[model samples]
Target: LHISSSWVRDSRFWKLVDQPAPKLESFSFVMERECDVEDNLTVLPRIFQDDMPKLRNLALVNVSSWPHNRFANLTRFSLEHQPPHIRPTFPEFLAFLAASPKLQELVL
Candidate 1:
């Protein structure tokens, strides 16, 4: 699944997906905030819990919060344009990296 929205008002897109995506392999979301609006600082809801076992590639742009879940099978991961306050700490980032030993490409 790939989604790019240029006029997002809030960050609740993930919450609308109540069911798990069992066959999802790649997911990408990009939200371009309007200049006149306040930054979207909402943390995204945890996605699909532990049900996305086949997920491999993930990317997010202009997003404030990272989901508090482990993705052990990710081979490509990217995050961009995150606010400083919501960025993961070094230890937390390291742990995130540690969890995905099969990761081949990473972008921060």
Candidate 2:
């Protein structure tokens, strides 16, 4: 699933991404605009918590914070254009990396 829109900053859009989809493997969420307080955005989890076993590639564009969670099968992950104010701290980013044991390619 590829979602590229400013609307992705809305948490409701994340609910759609969180829904169980057995065939979901690769997910790319792009937000054309940076989120602000008016957006009422919160830290979003990686999206696939216990589901999406086959998920391998994940990408987030112009996002805020990503929760630290393990995606055991994930291979490729990318994050782009996160503003310093909303970007994950080094420790948080490191925790995310530690979680994805199979991660091979990473783009920041």
Candidate 3:
């Protein structure tokens, strides 16, 4: 799944299904907010519960929050244009890297 939109609200861009993506191999979401709008950061809900066994690629742009899932099979992960306040802590980012042993590409 890939989504790219401009001038979208943080809430509206994240209304995803509350279920596992069992067969999903790649997922990317890019949202661009209007320049005049202030950031209303929101945490991504724990919908998948870290059960995406087959997921290999993940990317997000201009996202305010990180998901609470441990991706074990991800081969590529990318995060771009995130606000400084919403950036992951060092340990948190390390934990995510540690969880994905198979990760081969990472972009920030």
Candidate 4:
């Protein structure tokens, strides 16, 4: 399920995210914006703290901060087009992967 739109209001987006997706297996989120504007969007840690145990494929594009821990059962993960300032450090990225023992493919 791909969701694409122009200038989605922040409240509307978060409202959709706040809903529970219990059986979700794969999720990819892309926030389209002009390159010149700063991308300050953040994914809170609790977004995936529960109800995503079956998630296998996860990808995030143009995201600023990803602070979730729902990759324990993921098989494929990708993070792309992130802003320089909000990107995670190499060590932090490694630690995030370390928690995903079942991960088979990774793209940073």
Q: Please, what are the lDDT tens digits per residue for candidate 2 over residues 1-108?
A: 998775545767867867766678898877676555625344566565557888899887766765455677889999876666777678877777888899999998
lDDT of 1 at 4: 83
lDDT, candidates in the order shown: 0.76, 0.73, 0.73, 0.70
Which number leads on TM-score? 1
> What would the C-alpha RMSD of candidate 4 be, to one decimal place?
2.4
Q: How do all the candidates rank in terms of lDDT, highest first?
A: 1, 3, 2, 4
TM-score, candidate number 3? 0.79
Which regions of candidate 2 are displaced past 4 Å?
9-15, 34-49
Regions of model 4 farther than 4 Å from truth: 5-8, 39-45
lDDT tens string, model 3, 1-108? 887776444455445535667888998867655323335333455545566789899987776766778888999999877776668899988998999999999998
Winning candidate number (lDDT): 1
Error of 1 at 28 (Å): 0.3
lDDT of 1: 0.76
lDDT of 4: 0.70
Score every model by TM-score.
Answer: 0.81, 0.76, 0.79, 0.78
| Candidate scoring better on TM-score of 1 and 3 | 1
Backbone collisions counted per model: 0, 0, 0, 0
